[model samples]
Target: MEFSSRARQRHLRLAGDRREPYPHSLQFYQEPPTESISLAEFESFAALAEDDYDARRKDHISHFILRLAYCQSEELRRWFLQQEMDLFRYRFHELTDSLRQKFLDHVNLSFEAVSALLSGFVLRRVCLMLFKIVGLSDAVDLFRARRVFIKDGFAFVPLKDIDAIVLNNYRKNLSKALALTARSLPSIQSDERLQPLLNHLSHSYVGPDYSVQKNTGKISLEHIDALSVKSFPLCMRQLHKALRENHHLRHGGRMQYGLFLKGIGLTLEQALEFWKKEFIKGKVDADKFDKGYAYSIRHNYGKEGKRTDYTPYSCMKIIMSNPPSQGDYHGCPFRHSDPELLKQKLQSYKVPPSGVTQVRHNLFGALFNEALFLNFISY
Candidate 1:
């Protein structure tokens, strides 16, 4: 079964849209595929034999198949470009060392023996091209952050830096192409079958569902304290700590953290006891706890209201929705916390500055991008 499943996935990847070949020219620009392809693709393509027509055709056709779905919206286009770049990088890495060097030469980016002065001169020209292609804002951000260095008013960019530039260029052209495609989508939507398939593909999950859990009853209330210290995600850990220290949590915090505790295997009775004990120790007396908070706790456990077994919040959910208001510690710190406070919190947690920077970059680059993309699609 596993073998068959793998074979099916491989087949789908290589032979996308097997029903009929797209009759129209779907190429985004007049440039030949070799020149128009991303830098990563250029490297991988260079490694292939000249007569490998079947492999080349497969690569060409796959792009158009994706374009069909991805051209539906700006968000989908961005996602498709990222996925293609990732695929290109994987294939490029698989090339032999000699082939990789040869690819550099073929792309006119043989950086190893170039003098620093020459490299800087080349990079300034490349940066100009990038600014024209990707616009000033994105070009500046991409170059300033990675794989480029500046000295004495000129910039030096390695071959690796060219990958980012090429990807950005491809993305810009693709965005324009998608706009053209979108103009034609109304006519294409007349096809009842293709319409649904295109819609499904556009909204499909591109990454793992982080909310999934194989075992729901693995943890017990007795061990939650130790687990929060050692195993909880940062958001949950902070919520746990806040609850412990204050002996109470606001409604937002309680809903967010209570669901988490329930998902980790707290029985309804145990959860009620836990919240009641903590709340009574603070502002809420036993009567107030029973009157106001108990129902919500039971509601989260699926015993009241709609009886929905509400899942614990995923990272994306925490980052993108119902951000913590003042005094609330429930939402994503990366999205909601002040930068200086976030820095101090990370330092207090003994995270190195570099690690903190990396965490911030990953959150902003991946999570925030996804959130924005989702918003684009939904709105």
Candidate 2:
């Protein structure tokens, strides 16, 4: 995105209180850009200079470029899919009734309003396009809810619900397109120029890294146990409990918990001492613990091998990663644990029985405040 000279003429410019300009487009959307956007955007918006590249062509080309870049991994694919779907939903809702029809026509999705089905009560609305004829099984929710009229083996969706049908169709097509793109990776990866760019796109982190903790090493070992009660996140609390009770965690648990602790403030020396003491208290003596476990903790802090400092896994990463196995305590409880098991864990934590409804649909997105999350679940 570019701005014209008139942007400086605007009273409120596109810049944050931090005096920072909005970054590239993806980061621009990922973070709140009110401070940085309005000024620069309006400035750019005002100056439709002759030299400016074609905005429509840029938007179209940019999406295809991203498709190639983001189709490399499951995480990237899902992220792209979600962003595109959200954009579609927003744009669709913004369209006027006539504009919406035009867009549908533009996309070659011919949808006729089913208001013509009945006479007198409602009639004569139907026209050029036919209603999206979906299999009875495909529109089961609409069928069950009695939202759409069924004829023979097809479901006739009304104009209001046609967007949902069209949206699903786009999702399926886009997903298949991504899959087909992925299949071409062998040839694509050999293109030295594109490979590096695609690799970067797949692994890009949008916001602040939890690295360079301001309070690093300020947190003492003794305080960790206290922190677990209410301060630690749900998964971290569970991992801490398991580590203490068993005096050992399998590789997955250790990686997850160890990085989290490092992110919080545990320094290299403290981390080594913390693990050594705990492991010795169990079956592993000091020597065995040093041999088996010491390297991993150091590696996490960028001490060994290639020594690339690793960031702690985000909640999203943990959610997307492999499901934890039995005797493993790495994954999010709301996500990985059985429903009954999750409820029991909440009960064990003394969460009110009445507040356990959030577990019903395995929804964890709204789980910021534990008490309120439980309350929401009950709803």
Candidate 3:
């Protein structure tokens, strides 16, 4: 049986709708001026700028450039920055000294990228032409903080590079998955009114985590597992495909992405609304959705921005890499890749499984409880 078959069955039983394909150009969207800064230059400048990067005030210039550079709108950047700041404050201290130093080193790269954007390095453009210049993976690398989460044996990259790949992957797979969605959930209605919402959920919303955390706190095991199962729809189908086929992550990687998305504001109501729209009959009873899926998304998204909304860092990577424990949700591959272990997991994924370490290993890298989380969020 194909992995999607299992996932599909699980999804259907869990009340997922096979959504219609999103009608969108599969092109990378980016502004031009933001693309001018070279990775080397961005890193060099970020190293110098972090010391000067002010935390108290919004660096409008830096913020603006990043908005353009990443080809995201300013509103998106503001929300992202707010999320990142909140995450960093919670997980910063939990990071090992080595990870902290490494993060600080690359954080400068992020600063430089932002600075370049603020300074008008990129100009507006039709295609994300700048992606070719820097590569999509490199962009995500510039801001990803997962490397700081684990203790050893992995490679790390800057967040700028990481975003590039993640965004591109999302763009590519989202369309493909949407195209196949109708077939996937054939029981659903062709004229479903909710198709647009499904398209939005499947296509527009999912991407990589570039935020950092400032401290670490107790992560509940039950919460971790619940979010793990709940993450499928909120995460892109392609990512879901990658994790299940990849094996090792029946746990780790799946949980990580799930929790991370929860931490970032993808909510249960939104998720349910998304799924129901894709149903074949254009009908998903509210009571059924409530009984089966709604509660988990609520638990995952957490109480309307209160600190109660929590997901563990351990489970997030399942969407990014193989599970650390084959089927358990306790570790991150990017941060915890033991060479021998990685080989086994890779083998399971049919990914050579040999000395195959560090396919953007550094892409790896969160934290805290509610009352304390509130303090962090307020800051």
Candidate 4:
């Protein structure tokens, strides 16, 4: 009855009306099969061995179905392509050794001899396909740099060079695609049947929940000076340094850093005293501090007004939201600080230039990876 009706709707949504044969050919690629497949059937097939008869049939068919849904937007298409590439890699890995060799030979991938020693051979191949727009100048540069082979004015980028180029291209496309997706999300989400899946696909967790107060009362104000030097995140460390040096923090800085201190176990009384002493050293008198700022500190600790126990900002939250203005020491250093200034700051802290570069690279990679994971759950 109701269940059957719902099932039928789902089938139609996934498999199409089934009146015409599902066109297996997608734009730009003609590798998929010509058969039609329902969403449920595609899922089952994708989960089976590649050698399975039905799985082979459905593999090619399922891609076209996904293409139909994903072709609505560039973001969706890129995500779909990446996911299909991942699936292809997995399936390729699962093939027999002989079959693997045969597949490589069929693809005319001579570099397989070099890449077999390294993992991600399949991924490298897929990424190469995604990043085929390498310009002639760039190809010539890569050739001159001995990083790629050039034949007949075409540069064949090596496996080692693939990651950087692929990641850069992915970043550019993904950023634009995300902006486009956000603009178009309202229309895309209008369909009740598609909204849940679309929302799920877009949802991503940046890191662990900072709202959970597992470390409450674990830190003491007496040790904060020492802890700030050693255990604090870069953002918090910068705030602490600014506070110690200037003896005053702007409202934004106070809120951002105070909440973090509260999360790390600064009592309401300790926080008040800390801020009071720091402010008094500057232009603010003790009386002004009590009148203007004490309530806010208390409020942050759930002792005033709404008594809401606000959580500390997570790294993602700090990075993505409410960026600090000029004269503010709060906000993510990675996001807020000027790059050259940040490098100088890091060097002043005794980090070597190479280490600074590595840190920057790692942070960028993490941010990009998180963005990719959240924006496209299928990948």
- Each model's lDDT: 0.61, 0.67, 0.35, 0.59
Q: Predictions ranked by TM-score, top down?
A: 2, 4, 1, 3
> Ranking under lDDT, best-scoring first?
2, 1, 4, 3
Model 3 ranges with Cα > 4 A deviation: 1-239, 242-255, 263-270, 273-289, 304-307, 311-326, 334-341, 344-379
**Angstrom error at residue 252, model 3:** 7.6
How many residue pairs clash in all the candidates, one count each?
0, 3, 74, 0
Model 3 worst lDDT window (10 residues): 19-28
TM-score, every prediction: 0.51, 0.54, 0.23, 0.54
- lDDT digits (tens) for residues 1-379 of candidate 4: 4558889889777655442232321112234455554545643432334344344455455444444455556655555555544344334444565664454344333233333333533455544432232444545546566766444454556544543343334344444544554576677568675566444433333456655766666766678888876566667878999998999999888888998888878777788888898889989998898899999998888889999988887665665457788888887775567768877877676655666655544443234323422332211
Candidate 4 weakest ten by summed lDDT: 19-28
Q: Between prediction 1 and prediction 4, which has the larger lDDT?
A: 1
Cα RMSD to native, each candidate? 11.7, 11.0, 25.4, 12.2
What are the runs in model 1 whose C-alpha is more than 4 Å off? 1-164, 167-171, 174-184, 187-189, 198-218, 229-235, 238-256, 278-292, 313-379
State the RMSD for candidate 3: 25.4
Better of 1 and 3 by lDDT: 1
TM-score of 3: 0.23
Show model 2 residue runs off by greater than 4 Å.
Answer: 1-59, 73-79, 86-102, 120-149, 158-163, 183-191, 212-214, 222-250, 272-379
Q: Write the per-residue lDDT of candidate 2 for residues 23-137, one digit (tens) a residue.
A: 2111112211222223233213311222122443233344555677778888778867866765566556656877676666655665544444434443244333355555676
lDDT of model number 1: 0.61
